[model samples]
Target: MRTVRIWAEHSPFDLKDELKKRGYRWSSGDEGRPKGWYVDIDEALEADEVRYLSEHIYRRDVDLFTQIITPFERYSVRA
Candidate 1:
């Protein structure tokens, strides 16, 4: 499985909806941040597709990290 880290200026709820439309699942994570979100993708999905959607379609700013680690020090992904 592959994971991607994405940052968004929109609320989490809105971002989740946008992600769903793109065929990505919103794994639950830190909810306090107003503009941060994360999602997991199957390894089979094309990396370029993920980048394009995250960069253009979703239009939410994101950091592409190979690891599944969260970018923020204080924020933790909720189980």
Candidate 2:
């Protein structure tokens, strides 16, 4: 199954607990990536995952865009 790594430009500190509760893990800026929390989910869950994340991230009311990082993963940016 394909997996997708999800993360954002800024670490949503306010959502830390919720994120952890949902199984997201912290990444310490390894390999040029930004420091933040991330979760890898099956590609099939992309829509729901994006919806949930977009609702709680900073500036929740605005639409966001995705920057494809790979065939199976991407970085989310605020619109």
Candidate 3:
């Protein structure tokens, strides 16, 4: 599966709902040592779905986070 490493400071605001729509979960897994949030783009997602998740949704929101801080750090993941 293809995986994209999203920087902790680049996460979107609606990350929880958006990722849920795509059937994938996010995790920092101790990425950046708690400096910020980080999520991965997994290959398990359908090819088309990946674009929506990354470019349209993830990337789009990330572009906005360039100004915010805490909003970029908050996220919920699967247990």
Candidate 4:
């Protein structure tokens, strides 16, 4: 199995409430995770996730990471 994690890096303070309402949890940067809002979902949900995320996230605030091994590799999308 693989892990697909989508992140909202440097997310605007304005969106925090909506993000929480939408199921994104805030990370305090503990356990080597970035400080921001993120959601862990299966890869199958990527399109749906992107659609929802795109509603609140702009290009500069997005940071996507997939875990295949140590030190997560970064990926990008138009969100």
**Each candidate's lDDT (Cα)?**
0.50, 0.67, 0.45, 0.68
TM-score of each: 0.34, 0.66, 0.33, 0.64
Worst 10 residues of 3 by lDDT: 62-71
Error of 1 at 40 (Å): 1.5
Tell me the lDDT of candidate 1: 0.50
Q: lDDT by residue for model 4 over 7-44, one digit each (tens)? A: 77676788789888878898899867788888766777
Mind sharing the TM-score for model 2? 0.66
Q: Model 4: how far is 35 from its true place, Å?
A: 0.7
lDDT of 2 at 46: 70
lDDT of 1 by residue, 5-76 (tens): 443334346456666675554434445533344444445554765567567655664545333433363265
Candidate 4, superposed: residue stretches over 4 Å from native:
1-3, 59-63, 68-79
Separately for all candidates shown, the number of backbone clashes (residues 3 or more apart, or on different chains) is 0, 0, 1, 0
lDDT score for residue 68 of model 3: 22
Residue-wise lDDT of candidate 3 within 13-72, one digit each (tens)?
A: 666665556444444545434333444445353344534545865564233111222423
Error of 2 at 3 (Å): 0.5
Model 3 deviation from the true structure expressed as Cα RMSD, one decimal place: 10.4
- How far residue 8's Cα lies from its native spot in candidate 4, in Å, is 1.1
Backbone clashes in candidate 3 total: 1
Which pairs clash inside model 1? Answer: none
Top-TM-score candidate index: 2
lDDT of 2 at 63: 37
